[model samples]
Target: MNSIDKLRIVFMGTPEFAVASLDALVGAGYHVVGVVTAPDKPAGRGMKLQQSAVKKYALEKELHILQPERLKNPQFLEELQALKADLQVVVAFRMLPEVVWNMPPLGTINVHGSLLPQYRGAAPINWAVINGEKETGVTTFKLKHEIDTGNILLQERIPIGENETAGEVHDKMKDVGANLLVKTVNALANRTIEEIPQSAASIEEVTFIKHAPKIFTETCRIDWNKKVSEVHNLIRGLSPYPSAFTTLDGKTMKIFSSEKEIAVPTSEPGAYETDRKTYLKFACPDGYIYVKELQLEGKKRMGVDDFLRGYKFN
Candidate 1:
């Protein structure tokens, strides 16, 4: 057998974003010995236990699964050690302790959403869109103690469409990251790829590095007082989850999609201009943000026209 065939891999991740990478590894005929994911947690209106996307896929594949409530638990550590993995691949999983990440002889692999040294944090894709960046990419690197500041193994650039939402970028990135991860693993198994320090990778640019911290509720509030571009980017950055919202008639209305009109608004920022039949837009300093899709308080998400059709003006 070849090197890759003999290499035992332990896959670790939780969300749907991580599923693609695991699937790609399995599809590539790698020997995945174990899958470590988050424990099933109560969720939804029914409050039933919900399995992570990675766990579900692992179950379907009949792979050995482990859901540890705490990474440092002795029982979990012993069980993990028993897997005898040559390499551990992590994507969208919780932070790992030294014992866990340092367990495998070949070391741990991480598939991060953004290029290392840029947008490295809990929410890379969201911050990239929010910053109105034109391009971003995936980076596969070794897992180190210092969060995402690991040595780079492989890199792939992905362009961000001007109006793309974080969710859309996420969808694109998962697939790209999956493919790159497979390539990274195969090269590593063959001992063909070299690890480059993040410093070397950024020396060519040496630009001001941008970070992507976790997004909170305050980050999701739409500030129409800002310039139109900033407000629109904020809306796009948070779309499809914990969406950018503003007060409309003393009630909260979440905007899922919007179009920016670059015209001076007659009304002050945060003021709404709706036809009461079709369009609904909010004024910003330099333009208007036309709401294409929205969810008003106590209402289901719908097109703006549909929302306008059923609502009465106060």
Candidate 2:
């Protein structure tokens, strides 16, 4: 048998993003021993329990699954050890303890959303888009003592369209990351890959490195006084979830899609200029952010035209 076929792999992930990587490993004929995913939690208006995307995929494959309430729990650790995994593949899973990640013989590998030593935190993709980056990609690296400060195994770069939202980038990244994981695994199995430290990924001893931190409510609020490009980037970066919002007629209006016009605004920032039929544009300090799609408080999301057709100004 081949070296890749002989080693036992444990796959750990929770969300849809991780499912892509797990599926790629299986499709490439890896001997994944067991799957570890988050416990099912109640969701939706009905509050019925919902299985994570990873768990659903595992069930379909009949793979042994582990859903521990806590990673450091004695029983979970014992069960993980029982799998006899040589390597662990982690995607969108929670942070792992040393006892868990350090247990496997070959060590744990993680698929991070951004290139290492760059956006190394919880919300990499969102931050990249918010910052108006032209290029960003995924990194597969070994799990070490620190979070994403691991040695890099493989990385693949992708371009970000001028107006692409975080959700759009996310869809593209999942597939790209999945393919890279398979390549990383095969190279490791063949002993052909040379891992690099995150520090070496860059040349200059720069003062600041970008970090991806969790987004909060304040981060999602729209500041109409910023430059047009900066404000547009913020809107795209947070689109389709926790959207960028501004107050309109004393109601919160969350914008999902917009186009920026670089024109000196006649009205004050955050003021609206609309024809009551075709367009709704909010003024910024230096330009206008024309809304294409949005959701108002207590109303369903719709095109700006559709929303304007029925709504009245206060």
Candidate 3:
């Protein structure tokens, strides 16, 4: 495992978040022998085939790319075996089969978006914001049979601001994850790191575990029955992506940013109030959520002031 021995690395990822980790590995002089990403699928209005973010970047770097439609395909497996990688790195990617994850000598190391044993599923960044957590961070762990149920390698913590949206936190996590991946790889090369199991005893007296399931349209719909702060956090959690939505004049409106109003509202829950001049506020179980940024159905996103100038929520 000498520094110049050229440890063969394979990277598995699909989205922009994973791209940061891949770039970091390349910049650190790791021998990224191949990349495995999702197959190109039809997307957009024209239904054009689109390559994944990871594939695009791998091509630019002139690295070998593997886009297997099925992980169990014998042909794909053979190609992966031919790479003869020493380690694999996964980031923001799909669940891997045991054969794929266990193929390498040093095993696969995953770059998860949140602290291990917490937010351990598909959408960690969004769920952390949705749950209104004060602090969240990234973790590197060895791959196991279960998703995100691997032994911890290294972790770096970051604070989540009260007013921050999931998108904001996502960008910050990307950078933090890149740096952590570099450190983890260096430690692995030197055989100086220890893997800690994620059982209850391994954590430092933390009990509750938060889950990060994939977001859906149903989950993103604004639940006005919750407290104003809760609803506000939901909006921020899904912002700039699978944004929180509500019905406005029988049309769907996607909410990106909101402010909580603690004052008791005279209107019933789910009711909306607007100055018809510059602000629109929706009543929740306890108070109101002042809409600051949103997009009405078939309309471009706009600020509260601009949205009020043309459309009145009558």
Candidate 4:
């Protein structure tokens, strides 16, 4: 098929992570027939319904959009069918019904945040950083019966820097995945692509097959018994999101940035060290984590210096 005569595409995604790929597709001249995002729901203190990032971008691009409360709803399915899309592209979206994913002639291709066969789940970016993997990447694959268990189309590896947070890696992956999406689309247009089964190799051989399950309050609590490096990774992995937290002076404190201190420590694990004049550091199994950025319970985010001026650590 000619580049201009390429198959129509239906995009499904909900968050900002997926926005880059969606924008890239439109900019690359692909015919995005429609977009499917989550329904707007009440958020924040005012409790106003907020549209998804994908929905907002789709509106600006003037593309048709669908925000079905349930994927199995008949009206939503009918509207989706009306688009007559030849292919579907999924990014950071929820699981789809078989009827929906199987509707497109070319099948649904998902832009997974992690390089497939690893970190396969709802929060790939966070898990990669938490697991201390030196490198991570994005993958384009055909959606199949199982979640993220698809035939691989293309993957581009990106290295994780030392002391890097998951948020940083996330931004980089967004750009890399966007470019990879354009490449995959062009290849599909020319029929030069091959889909490789993910099961061809044993799972044991996959070095970094970590799960990126959804984050919760309990999961974000700092485990001081763990090695300092592990605890450090945990803090950065969840930074600026469902952040890693601990209790201080009977109040919850979220830690956004920290530095590992290798010096010998006498304090027990979970004990904190601070001077009214300068800094706050928590003792872990191996060393100390000097918290440089944090937010105390019921307080706004602030630098260590600012936090020290008003709050005294015990």
Candidate 5:
């Protein structure tokens, strides 16, 4: 047997974004002993129990699965300890207590969505795009007491395309992160990795680091008073999830994709102009945000032309 085959691994994650890493490890001939994911919960109009994407993939792989309602449950802990995992890998999972994260001999490692010392939080991809950053990447780090504050194991940086939505960036990062996680695991098994402290960089160097807190309903409300570029970024950053919104005709309108018009606007910020056939746009402080994709309340997502075809502004 290969040396890597002797190192038992346990994976913890809950979403589609994490399936890539778990799949990569199994494909690479790693001995992933078990998987822990969120419990199936009711979803959709019919309220059927929906399994998490990671759990679905794990079930297909025939891997041992655990879905504990509470992380601190004694039964779950007993089962986890029974796995005898040499190391643990986490991606898109909830916070772990010390007993769990510290149980593995080689320690638990996390594949985070952003580079260290910046964009540290639950919604890194959304925040990076919303803040108009030119670049962001993935980081694999050892788990510690503080969230996302651990010794760095490996990282791979990627450029964020202009006008790209957070959903787009998320899709790209998942693959990159999967490859990097495999590399990190191989290096760890070979004892070739050197852990570096985040504080190794001076405070002056990382002063611009930003936090990526969880986005809320209030957070997605569009602020037309801002510059067109800023408003555009906000819309794309939240696209397809907690999407940026505004009220039109006293009903909510969700904006998905938009183009910016930088010419000085004739109308006040928050004011909208529509030709009732071709375009629907809102003015900002500096210019206009020409919304190409949007959804009106009680309607399906459609292009501006299609939206205009069915309804006329009073």
Candidate 6:
């Protein structure tokens, strides 16, 4: 145990992704003095109040928790200041006002989904897979004025399987990210780490930097005009949430998993062929994408064979 054990810390996060990091900190016996998370909101069919995953975990741990409607709220600021945290850790949370981030003596640190200086946006995990990258990783950095433009403290690289979905990568990265976050905190506490500016020469050499903006409805629609690989990547990248979709019988059908065939296409892009029993494949520029898992609008998710059995194209 180093000075970090005695440091008063505040952990801020929301969502399941953040929970793992928080849990790692707690499990490591960090002196977490406070927890801040988003407020409860209505969700689901009943629109009942739903607690954020962090909030629920905080409640179970019986830690001091804050759910401020606004970080700049005077009352919230007063309470936050009272915690007197030596450092604050943020993961998978909303952007913070400088006043909030600058509150602690050691300043704030964030666990970003990307390796930094690349995929710097709201949807790094999804975009990395969507762009067909074979490698993606987690980065921990000191927070500055710009979003994800912070100086790097530590990073851990991980490979993305060629055929893996975004959800699978997310699952793997969350645990890997949790361990890295703990390592970063320990390094910072022990005064053994140095900050590296993101614009350092090594990062600058990458000329074709890609940005990961938030995905939208238009982005999720299958562009059959693209090559089979691109189309396949898009489908896997968006799986399990905000899934890729295409029109079927004038109704929208979401694709969750797919297999690509690189043979020359016989039909126009977006055209499909099905024996109405075993397969449903759509043509693209270079080949066809066989829908392996999917769901029709207003229907439960099912395998392609099951979907083909019940779905009657008119």
Instruction: Give the number of the best model, judged by TM-score.
Output: 5
On residues 1-314, what C-alpha lDDT tens digit does candidate 4 reach at each position? Answer: 43645679999999999999999999988899999999999999999999999999999999999999999999999999999988899988889989999998788999988877888898898988988889999999999888999899999999998699999999999999999988988887788999888877575856546778888889899999888889989999998898999999989999999889876778999998888668889898778999989999889999999999998555
lDDT ranking, high to low: 5, 6, 1, 2, 3, 4
Model 3 ranges with Cα > 4 A deviation: 2-5, 200-207
Compared with the true structure, the alpha-carbon lDDT of candidate 4 equals: 0.90
Clash tally, candidates in order: 0, 0, 0, 0, 0, 0
Residues 185-294 of candidate 3: C-alpha lDDT, one tens digit per residue: 99999898999988844455346777898888899999899998899999999999999999998999999999998987999998888879877999987889999999
- Model 6 residue 151 CA deviation (Å) reads 0.7
- If both were scored by lDDT, which would come out higher, candidate 1 or candidate 3? 1
For all candidates in order, the CA lDDT equals: 0.93, 0.93, 0.92, 0.90, 0.94, 0.93
lDDT of 2 by residue, 222-244 (tens): 99889899999999999888789
Q: Given candidate 6, what's the lDDT at residue 217?
A: 98
Task: List candidate 2 stretches off by more than 4 Å.
Answer: 201-206
TM-score of each: 0.97, 0.97, 0.96, 0.96, 0.98, 0.98
> In model 3, how many backbone clashes occur?
0
**Prediction 2 global C-alpha lDDT:** 0.93
Error of 4 at 205 (Å): 1.3
Model 5: per-residue Cα lDDT over 181-243, one tens digit each: 999999999889999999897878688778999999999999899999999999999998989
Candidate 1 residue lDDT tens string, 9-60: 9999999999999999999999999999999999999999999999999999
Instruction: Give the least accurate 10-residue stretch of model 1, judged by summed lDDT.
Output: 199-208
